[model samples]
Target: MCVEKTPWELVIDFHGHTCPDIALGYRVAQLAQREMGIRPAPDSECLVKAYTQSCALDAVQVLNKATIGRRALIIEETQHHIYQFHFTGTQEIHQFTVSSDVLDHLKALQHPDLSPRERQNKVLEGVQYVLTLEESAFCQYDKIPGELRKL
Candidate 1:
């Protein structure tokens, strides 16, 4: 018998491995879908503007159907885990910023003292943390004032 893969499974497969960044991206994509409605909304064209570069973008592409190949995902190196979503069907834009608490933990995982193995283990733990974090604790969301979505 064959079983279908969950969205998270597909994202992990595409990303080649799981990490905090991938988990972060997964949560962001799921929340964006919740906030903006599922993909292929009638006559809708969706674009994602990410303020940082990381494996998280993979989740957005896998789950949100916003891919760099399609020119639907743009990255600006603001060094923050902020993601914005725009749809041609609506003037409103949805924005999500990873919370500082989570960011702090992610930074702690990067300490120089930890051995490579230790860091890897901690990162896996972080993946679980990010995946299980309370919805409100994971990120902050907002709806920006409607404006023409620029290409």
Candidate 2:
């Protein structure tokens, strides 16, 4: 008999490691899909614009099927954790920002005194913490202006 893996398990495999950032991204991708009422892209049909480069980006690529190589993902350098998703067929854009409280929690997880292995373990713990959170707890949505919206 075969056992089915949870979506989080698939996300961890695709992301190459487990961390809070990846978990956060997984949640964000899920929320985006729910809000837009869209399924994962079959190919390069969806575009994701991320405001910062982080472990979260990997999860977004995996969960949304939006990849940089396929021109379905865009990374913009910024000091914020904001993401925008655009679907080709509907010309819809969904924008989201990580909540400041969640950001503070993530930042507090980092420590300078821990060994490398200890740090890794702590990050994994952080991932678990994030996984336990409610969707509305970690992020907030931003309204997109009609003029700036694009498919």
- Per-prediction TM-score to the true structure, in the order listed: 0.90, 0.82
Q: Which regions of candidate 1 deviate over 4 angstroms?
A: 39-41, 147-150
| Model 1: per-residue Cα lDDT over 1-151, one tens digit each | 9999999999999999988999999999999998987644776878899999999999999998888987889898988999999887677889999998998988787868889899899988899899899988999999997733445
Residue 107, candidate 1: alpha-carbon lDDT: 78
Error of 1 at 143 (Å): 0.6
lDDT of 2 by residue, 47-104 (tens): 7888889888888887788888877888888968899987765545789898889889
Candidate 2 clash total?
1
Clashing pairs in 2: 91-151
Best by lDDT: 1
> Which ten-residue region of model 2 has the weakest summed lDDT?
142-151
lDDT of each: 0.89, 0.79
